[model samples]
Target: MTGSRGPAAASAWIPLVVTVTLVQAVLALMSRALPLFGMPLTASSGMPPEAVGQLSSATSLGSMLFFLWGPALLVRLPSIRQLQLGCAVSAAAMLFCAAGRWEGLLIAAFGIGLGYGPSTPAGSDLLMRVTPKHLRATVFSIKQAGVPLGGLAAGLLLPAVAAFFGGVDAALVTAAVLALVAAAALGFWKGTVDDARPAASAASPFRHLLLAPVRLIGLLVHAPRLRLITAAGFCLGVAQGVLMGFFPVFLSDHAGWSLTAAGAAFAVLQGLGVGGRVVMGWMSDRLGDPVRALSGICLASGLTMALLASIGPGSSPLWVIVLSSLAGLTVVSWNGVFLTGLAEAAPEGRVGEITAGGTFVLFSGYVVCPLLMQAVIAATGGYAIGLILAGLAPAIAGLALMIGAGRRQR
Candidate 1:
């Protein structure tokens, strides 16, 4: 049993990992392009503070809709079919964004968010089924790193495309083309979907939320240490979202840096995030406790973020770049650790349910941060206070994890 099972598991897992990673990378690139598009709209339309908040909320709203509905649908559809459909929808959405109409762009953003939302949980499910217990953390981390890598690629390449083409629309069109190609590739890949149906006697999504394992993982996320992890993620998202959402404005308003330079800098952060995930994952696997590794990373990330905030507006651009890269590294590492921990915590057959539930909670941070941070900035008249508050969130989260670790030890 052991001999045959080991090789079989490896074959099954490797392809799924590769496909999901590619899909995530492509989606991240697409996501990076949206804020660049929105910044100009905010500038040109003379959008009010509230309008800015709404625009930011639109992405999260789209994600929320997907988060709410995706799990139910995952049970009904085959994983491959779901992925294929998601990629197709994402392709169409990107094309819509490329069309450059205001209504079209909004629709595209929402559609893309909805499409991408299912891919993670669904992919995670697939990974869990195929990967052996011992290798789960390593494989999951490698897969999740694709997010940052994609974001990095988008950050670096999209702006250059926009510069050469002389408009954001061209970059959007390029992204659409890339997504379409990815979808095409996925369509041709051969694999069985990991379709673990909920028992016939199961309750609805809300009811499932109350199930023992699901509730345990959910509480785990809200646990003091995990709460800090989520909060750090929230702050990271805010910093990242703001930079992606409005770095052009920052460049134009405060720094003499051009749009291209600012965009590249933003991309650098995303690129570094890939390395962060790998380092964090390796540490988690070797240290034999994901929670502790996550806490350490968050602490490092929090300190870096505070340092970044302390670098005043007119400070050296090099300092901003350095801090941003460090923040990206530490901030993005938490996802892999947390997700793996949640999966590990689940009861056997309920892995899918627990993972999906945990992801729903984590994504809430993504949904809420952009809009909330923007609102705070609008109210406060300066980003300094907002950034400072954001920086502290991760530190608190890390401390929570330390306390939890101590409790578990005792």
Candidate 2:
């Protein structure tokens, strides 16, 4: 009912998809680069390394705040406008976060987070509105690849740029400019795919905004499938957050690898993720049930986490690279399929709402994982505890998804 159907639908969605993907990539580059971006501050200003956490957590907090109200914004505004607003905010926030010090850093990080808040719900709304159902999984997966690609650029490209132009300032400025360009491109889209609004509902706009939060909470509480899937999101988030946040350090400190080797391993992991998203998403598309495919990926992800836990200093570097890269493919990949399945699970016209709710839980993992990892490490007196926990979480998530998918089959 929302997207154009047949031949027009396929062609129409491409430009929006490219726009949304670029926006996601730039935002991701900005956020993913934060810890890396802050290192110079730690070195020069003697800012505590802990300060990076504040910035990172602030971004998560900002995202949560957006999830609280972002769905409601889509209820009235077109997804493109919401997306453009997000881009503007992200561009400014990237610049602010890069330049600001101390309190400024925290505030800017929060702003960056806030800027990210609308992207998933708005992008999901836009994609689902315009994308034909048959192509949704593959196309969305391809779009989702932007996540890893942005990260790749951050890990690979930004460092190269920083070496000459120097530091995060130049890189952050580049991200900001791209964010503005993404916004400008969207402004020129001129499509009506989801631009039309229904006649004024019985409820006033103010009322819709006021109660949207309540509705979202209630939906999470009552929607059994969604609740299960979101819980899985939490599990996946914990594993992902820990994997990304700590893998490099683990390799350098614990595994006795050189910094360059650790970085290359991280790059391999991310590169695999970029390809895996599309491949898994395509498989999901063909399956006619993305959740089933997602379950298998989660299951594989758990297995890979278990493999990582077994990797120790005694292991060969070649063995480490192979296992670690596989871990990347399984753990870091699969978001596209997962999110596509989440949107598909929702009732029509409600993808935005579902995505917002789901993304909040996903981000909650980001907020909680650091503390959780520390606790697990302290309790067990080892990092192995963290890896085991990550392994178990995704395995449980896989089982939950398997059950959910089975029930749907019935």
Candidate 2, pairs of clashing residues: none
* CA shift of 121, model 2, Å: 1.1
Model 2 scores a C-alpha lDDT of 0.74
Candidate 2: tens digits of C-alpha lDDT, residues 114-192: 8777778888877887777787888788778887777777777666666678666776777778778878887776454
Write down the lDDT that model 1 would get.
0.65
The candidate scoring highest on lDDT is 2
Writing each residue's lDDT as its tens digit, candidate 1 over 74-182 gives: 5566566666677677777776654445666667777777767766666777777777677778878887888788878887788888779867778877887777777
For each candidate in the order shown, give its overall lDDT on alpha carbons.
Answer: 0.65, 0.74
Q: Which stretches of candidate 2 lie over 4 Å from their true place?
A: 5-7, 38-54, 98-102, 192-194, 197-207, 252-263, 310-317, 374-382, 403-410
Residue 44, candidate 2: Cα error in Å is 4.7
Per-candidate TM-scores read 0.85, 0.87
Indicate which candidate wins on TM-score: 2
